[model samples]
Target: MAMGNSVKAPLGHIQFCEENRSACRGRDNSPVVVKLTEARWNELIDLNTRINRQIRPVTDEKLFGKLEYWTYPRGGAGDCEEYVLEKQRALLAAGWPKSALLITVAKDVKNAGHAVLTVRTDQGDMILDNQIEAVLPWYSTPYRYIKRQSTREPAKWTGISDTRVTTVGSVGN
Candidate 1:
């Protein structure tokens, strides 16, 4: 997805940054697009599948007694944001460039806010969604892209010029 001007980040993300400082620390002004290899593709697909299958889809309120909370689903359950964080963290731990793994927010087909990991690769932006089993290209999804953690700085956000339009505020990213 093409990025737009910087914008205010979702409230949950701000709080997440406060709690998980390291996740939001660091900055690389230059853009990075990963060279996607066949092996890398398989790794991403398998990782997505495993995480989706492992974590129980529980709301933040149910899991943390809050309206919106962002953290790893280490306790076995979490919502979309947690899944995205987990995916991004996994790739980072595997030595993938942090700039290539973005935390994206968008609205689902129902207009409900949803979060997904958007990986910038040589091919294009690919969506790693908890709701979808297959790893799909960003344009292939039925989401209205809104904003995402900037590739240059994970803590900063930039709008996505998604012609479909939207924001997933209530969904928690």
Candidate 2:
């Protein structure tokens, strides 16, 4: 699916980017338009599972004694954003194009802020969420889709029109 116009980054995301500027520096902002091969899809699933199993979810308040969102986990545990970061990193290291992998923020079914990795594939936009093990189409989730990193610019982002999407499987924090 075509992405929407650029939008402002979420406050928490901005903070994470600022704190991790060194790592994010010089990142390519071009959109990823490549289609995923069968092997690539398997690899993505493996990476997602590895991170999901390895990183135990912890709240920002508990981890930092305050609200602090990090792009990647500094320790063994982290929240949603960190999961997305790790997955993105793994994909990048595996030679996946930076343009195709995006960090996305959305509101869950309960309206709580959540993060996930959005892989831009030729078939469609697939979401790799910490809350769920199975990778699914972006439109299949119960989230109130908010904004996602711009395909043209990683630092920049674009707004997503909210739709009444239904949850297809078990709920996750």
Candidate 3:
């Protein structure tokens, strides 16, 4: 998928990271405006690039092991969950609002399990995945949504796959 199409979402419709722009004016203090700044947005992009280096794609010959919500620092190689979890932690350290980061699962190009990040901004939803460094829209990603866990609970998020997707609840629930 083209990076331009994904990143070029309607800024008016989604949360956006505006640094020099004064997007927040009152006490309501929307989390999106609070977490994402122009500087932090750039940092997320940079961090995503750095994390991509650790990703080793899942292949039959590569060997594998079981992973779950409790495994900390899943180590050198991981499936989508570990990959996205690490990136989420990096974003938090960079000062991006934790609320802005979403741990989402989508159908991979092969119609298998896959994972990516969903960042909500006043501009729209921006997707960040090791597969692509541009941080495009979730829709722009080739994967289709199977599940999404609020960034607030990265480690707490359970089962993120097509099989469990059918039984999961909505974000607000």
Q: Which is the leading candidate under TM-score?
A: 1
Tens-place lDDT digits, model 1, residues 1-173: 77899999999999999999999988897878988899999999999999999899999999989988988885889999999999998999988999999999998878898999999999999999999999999998888899999888889999988885444456566
> In candidate 3, how many Å is residue 124 off?
1.0
Candidate 1 — what's its lDDT? 0.91
Q: Best by lDDT, which number?
A: 1
TM for every model, in the order presented, reads 0.92, 0.87, 0.59
Q: Taking the tens digit of each residue's C-alpha lDDT, what string does model 3 give over 1-173? A: 11111222122112212321232112223445334568867876787777777666553224333232311133466555556767866776766666667666667766776667777676667887867768786656666665554333332232333222223345873
Worst 10 residues of 3 by lDDT: 1-10
Q: Count clashing residue pairs in model 2.
A: 1
| Better-scoring candidate (lDDT), 1 or 3 | 1
Candidate 3 ranges beyond 4 A from true positions: 1-37, 58-64, 67-74, 151-173
Off by over 4 Å in 2: 26-30, 164-173
- Residue 43 of model 1, lDDT score: 90
lDDT of each: 0.91, 0.81, 0.54
**What residue pairs are clashing in model 2?**
32-99
Least accurate 10 contiguous residues by lDDT in model 1: 164-173
